[model samples]
Target: MNEITERDLLDFALLTDFESFLKHSMLTLNPGMPFLPNWHIRAIAYQLERVRRGEINRLIINMPPRHLKSITVSVAFPAFVLGHDPRQRIFSISYGSELSLKHARDFRSIVESPWYARAFSQMRLSRSLDDEATTTLKGFRKATSVGGVLTGLGGNMIILDDPQKPVDAQSKVRRDSLNQWFSNTLVSRLDNKETGAIIVVTQRVHMDDLSGHLMGSSDQWEVLSLPAIAEVDEQVPIGDDEFHTRRAGTALHPEHESLETLRGLQKDLGSYDFGAQYQQAPIPEGGATVLRNWLCWYDRPPERTTKTKVLLSIDAASKDGPQNSYSAFSAWQVQDGHYYLLNMERGRYNFPQLRDKALALAQRYEPTLIVIEDASAGIALAQELRSMGRHRVKAVPVERDKETRLFIQTSKFEAGHVHFPKDAPFIPDLLAELLAFPHGKHDDQVDSMSQALAHKFSGYTLDNLH
Candidate 1:
């Protein structure tokens, strides 16, 4: 046997630690580019190590595009994981065949290189026609796209790199189909359900995209959300008891993107897209439809006078289940053609509970007119109230979608006609749903607000904010 040398010792080091392997193999896949040390890289490597040891079964990594996510996650990771455990089968997937093949090629290149052999000297390869590299140990790394299958096989570790193209994720039908594939087909491909690990590295496409769906799964996912710019302070753990302090307003990887550059991208991509893709928040600050600049704050609405038109708009929950949407109603007082929100209440309730809650609140606020969406429980509530000789209750049938209704009232919000209480408990939830709009999960508040605006001001005209 050959005596151990300095090079041999170095190879052992590379084989043992994820950071060592990742740092050294940076040049193995991409020959020319120098590795600029980023905190996110270390953080990701640490998390992957945890995954390998079965510490984390589910990992969702959300970062901005072109931020070394593809290189580190798809290319280097498969090579590194298989190096330590050559028997570990890896199924790598991407949004398209081209991307999946590209990752397969990169992983194959790294595993075939002299550096990889030095570290994993026992691991052997096959010069195969398929987009795969098999080890002598009977394990392989195979690449496939979103709908592509592995055919009656499963992997120890599955990596989904950009599961959906940004545009495709916007379509509800496409998104739902992808979600079904993930929840049904892909999930069933785990070699060992209890011990297998799933790593999903993607940019946030929509609020209901693959990442969002996985987040709601029973198996909890440790989300590493490194936005292009930090929205809040966070301590991203890189190693045991070691952390990278990410300050608010600071860039995630300054070497790759400066804060000013990210701002420029926001302008280029628009707030909604930039917010989802880069910011990872999926909604912009200062609101999307109802701009915060136009939001008028109030301690209280002007005392109810004969001129004030009290409108109670209830957007009932579609059903009475814990998982279903919350039945929400917002009370607004219109005075001098301006709508000031008085109060809002929302909760998961059946018909009787919802009716009682509405009537109790209505007793206190004493609304002159009430508008409810003409669907689900809203229809029944409107009928019951009308049967009680409450002719003020109007069940408005909606021909347009939720987004269209909100968009129609965009002018009213921008014209500074809508006002929200400064310190109301429900204000945060209301504004969050309003700003998140069509993308957010719960649009009950948005429905209520829009319904009130359409019914009360159908005959009125206001000057646009010019």
Candidate 2:
């Protein structure tokens, strides 16, 4: 009778599930180093299983850096798939050829190891045919750089790992080139469209990055988005049988990444890089135009004997089109050289809806001055409100561009004259837009706030106050 060894039991377990295979292979690859299993790793295993089973054709995963994303998706998963069927043709690419080739070597090492051979005895890699980045059993596994030529080569599975580096993410040329290559070249290199799978795994760099472009365009991809810190209570999938319930403000993986470590990372990386790489939002830090860490947070406005002048500033949007600018309304109570932001509302609304929201805010805040930017929709809304004669509505024309207006009000924020509510739900969105000023996708909030500050500080408006 043949001897039944520990290796035999381990091999059987690995073949049973991808998760088991991943854990076992990781141990084999990195001897003596303990495998720290986290929810993200489990989630990745589940997604990889879906890809293996042909349940999902396209998959995009966005997570923070140094989260073992590359190991799980680009390296081990490809090796695991090939272990099942060595004939499978896998094509992997990264921002550079060196990185892609490095991962390819790692995958090749895993498949060629004695443990892997024991687990998958039938699959064999021919030394004569295989190189550092390419493996040939029946078909072949190839790896290349993002812009590298794949003239006649195609793949059963295509893995794109960090197509653009963090520094290159801001370049329009680089971003456009990546998007074009993906759309024109990389996508067309699938061997069998009906059964082939494509996986994109990277941290969000910009609102128009490859991940963003894919997500915005179609619902074809199954996206597994994981931010460093939990923003809200959510039920996150780990594996088919396991699930992780994440609470707001909780660390993604407390064992590997504690709250203190993340906070230190935030301080080290700055707001832009931290938000983009860690939080996966890609909102850059406020520049010279708008100083970072400017606004002070307050639970309530300072108590004063003098009357508080509540002012409602409106920056209206002309149309309710999907891509059109949003209508922003900011209610500020000016008291003793400080502007306390009482409330803020922003949304995409048509003429009637805009009018209704303005009227509602006016009634709720009971503002002494309702300043509306004298633009297309603003002009109409101001006139309608003035005709009602319930509140004082002032229609002020925006003579300067958004940047100029924002620049004028930057001093107020720098001087710590602007304050925001401590626990407001809109605080994150407002701060993100402010911090990413001139670069972020939305600017309506900044425009409205600037107008409010400009109107408040202007000598003429102060002297002519009702």
Candidate 3:
């Protein structure tokens, strides 16, 4: 550490305000005052300095949850800025009054603290808390909860802190309302002057939140998005390695000396959550269907045997012609609730080609039954196959909504009741569908398979036709 000069101390003191002036005089002035200026805070301070210089219009910090973002932005940092420019107007808003009040209280505490008094001995504060959105400070108006349009001069400084609550963030309706508030109420208040807005928050919902709005704009905003889990898809590991790589490329790279030390953080926290919460990586959506941990679990296939009772389930697509859908055939063995998916055939085959394949499979397996979803051209295919001496063919229409069927199947999967061969042909597809169900990404194969399984297990065949 080098010797501290009076000029440096005075400049640092000036950045904060008269409160800072008094605090420096009291020998309590330091980087780690009320809150430590961590790397993120330091980076934010640099940006805030730009705000002071009129270089940038907005600075948005979109960090993950529980990362000291609120304390830095809403409380200590804001106080520090006010200490420097007493006339600076800041309008801070959150989703609810309680949250807004909480941040306001934090600001009040920092201002009222003994250290703050010692920092700025002559700093004056308004005793009356204005019920109105605008409060007069030294003849300058500082607005609170004022809509963007209301700020006619544009916001000299606006702090949008955690605009969406955890619940509201997830609720589509509530999210839309909050987004509307930002677009209509908050943003409309900005004046032509260099309006400084610093947004610090943990993302609870989709990217289209406040941060999402600022994504493309370059002149008015700068976004710092750090998700809990960073995996884009199946190919990349979105956890620790990727996290360090991002940090290394950032301005804060020099602050962290060793990646190993960062990795050691796992000792204090569990890997699963640590990877997500701190690393800003996404966790695989796991719930009732297949256990998240059991996604990789499966039973090894038994040796091929002629004695096993085999059957095939066909989920036929539209016969109105090949509109890009395939005639999916899944071969399985029925034993209790578990159906071991064996072979799968999926392609855009014509009526004759599909008929021949279905017959070939029936003969090859010597199936105890051949269940098929009776819709589109499935009825015709079944009739034609039967006329060709394939009496095992049965047409089964779906009974209820696909969602309802998935719920039943998923319940079975969660209970560890569903069994499948280790070498199951469509196991990957099956698991993917199982996990992706209700999410509505890939349910076609599962929909077909469900129709066949419902018919086979429920003992409702074509013979039960009434």
Q: What order do candidates take by TM-score, descending? A: 2, 1, 3
Of candidate 2, the 10-residue stretch with the lowest lDDT total is: 127-136
Stretches of candidate 2 exceeding 4 Å from the true structure: 1-5, 128-136, 284-333, 336-430, 433-466
Off by over 4 Å in 3: 1-37, 117-123, 130-154, 193-200, 216-220, 227-466
Candidate 2 local lDDT, 99-181, one digit each (tens):
88778777877887888887888777764223234445665667788888899887788999999998887888888889988
| Candidate with more favorable, higher TM-score: 1 or 2 | 2
* lDDT (10s digit) by residue, model 1, range 212-299: 8888665589999888876546788999899988876688888778877877777667557877898776764456667767778888
- Model 3 RMSD in Å is 13.9
For residue 77, give model 1's deviation from the true position in Å.
1.1
lDDT scores of the candidates, listed in order: 0.81, 0.81, 0.54
Give me candidate 3's TM-score against the actual structure: 0.46
lDDT of 1 at 373: 84
TM agreement with the true structure for every prediction = 0.65, 0.67, 0.46
lDDT of 3 by residue, 288-362 (tens): 344555433346534555544466888777752423455777776655545656666665677888888888888
RMSD of each: 12.6, 9.1, 13.9
Among all candidates shown, the one with the greatest TM-score: 2
- Estimate the overall C-alpha local distance difference test score of candidate 1: 0.81
